[model samples]
Target: MEGPAGEKVPSDNQVKTFERTATGLVREISAFRTLVLDLMFTSPVFMFVFAILGIGIFVGADMVVSTLLALLIGFTTAGMYALLSIAYPRSGGDYIFISRILSPPLGFMVNFVFTIVNISVIGTEAVWVSTMALGPMFSGLGAIMNSSSLASYASVFSQPVYIFIIGAVVMLVFTSVMFFGTGPTFKIKSVLFFVAVFSVIVYIAAIGLTSTSAMISNFNHLSSTSYQQYSGIVTSNGLPEKFEVVPTL
Candidate 1:
């Protein structure tokens, strides 16, 4: 007999120790693909804001110590998952692995909660990518390149309707990519790896090549505001020149 995926299915169990023949999912994704997915999950584009949030909360924390601690935590967690993958090399993800290895009830509870969190993350991340990432990126590029057309496009992106449309399109595109299959999804992510690398290089170059004065000049050119006026406004409404802990729980 043939299984749904066209793989041959045994009519009877040959091994006396086994209860019966059962169809098992074939593992399709390679180790390299899994590594790529892991890299993309931890990529700066998705994670940079969280890193900033950590800094914000732990203001004046020792950078070296913080980094080492984070590395230790990440390494241990990643190692656990890596070991799990090695033990269960099937297409079935965390839910399947957990259910098979542990109690089904516990696995179900975990997967249920995870699914709920993932739904919220997906919606919010879509909106955030459009508004926070894309909007600022286009605006900054327009400012840097002095492109009136790009600036106009950025203004269009500022509207709620346009932002929603772009976010929906992004969500739809990714959903479709996943629905098609893992192979195509893996290829697309591999391409995005290059794009992410290029973005990081550009970001570093922008920081290294441009000075504070140049940035101020660009802002002035775009906003028609002088550095003195900007400084005054910042002083009036922003953080104090000297750092002090704000009242918080």
Candidate 2:
């Protein structure tokens, strides 16, 4: 019999060949696709600020060391997830594994907290992406065109009404896609995966090409003497830069 997502059931003798197996999920996703999804989950677009400015700009020459440490932690966490996924082979992730291995009550508590956090982060992240990523990107394009009026026009994305509307639309689109099924969701994610990889490469190349002297000069101007002021600047800029500093591109 065929399961959801077109996963076919193996015969009794066929199943005996493997040490362990699960029949619920479709085996449509390939290893490369899994790698891409894992990459997106771990090193998301939001992490660009940390990888670029946090390590390259602030930490300076120790960027490689910092990156290696982060990779070690990330891989260790990934390994655990892999093991759990193998053992459980279900959709619910931590909820399934915890509920099955530990206790249902404990698993419910854990997933409940996680669900709340995720719901909260959705709106916040949407607003952030609108104000920080899109707004600045358009504003920079306006600058290239030498139009202050265009820059001001683009800044509308930061407004409460605009942010709310755009965020709602994005959320609706995402929700619809997810409701459709795993196959469609996986297809969309695969496209995003390539884009993510390309963006990462570009970010790294940009940093690598920049002279250390220039970065140091920029850092000196951008650095704050106090933590409070520094945090304020970072929050205002959305990706952590001096409050007065403006992007030329």
Q: Clash totals for all models, in order?
A: 0, 0
Best by lDDT: 1
CA-lDDT, candidates in order: 0.73, 0.70
Q: What TM-score does model 2 achieve against the real structure?
A: 0.66
Tens-place lDDT digits, model 2, residues 180-224: 887888889899888978897898798899897776665555443
Residue 220 in candidate 2 has what lDDT?
A: 55
Q: Which 10 successive residues of model 2 have the least lDDT summed?
A: 240-249
Candidate 2 residues lying further than 4 Å off, grouped into runs, are: 1-28, 51-67, 89-92, 212-249
Candidate 1 residue lDDT tens string, 129-148: 76778778888788778888
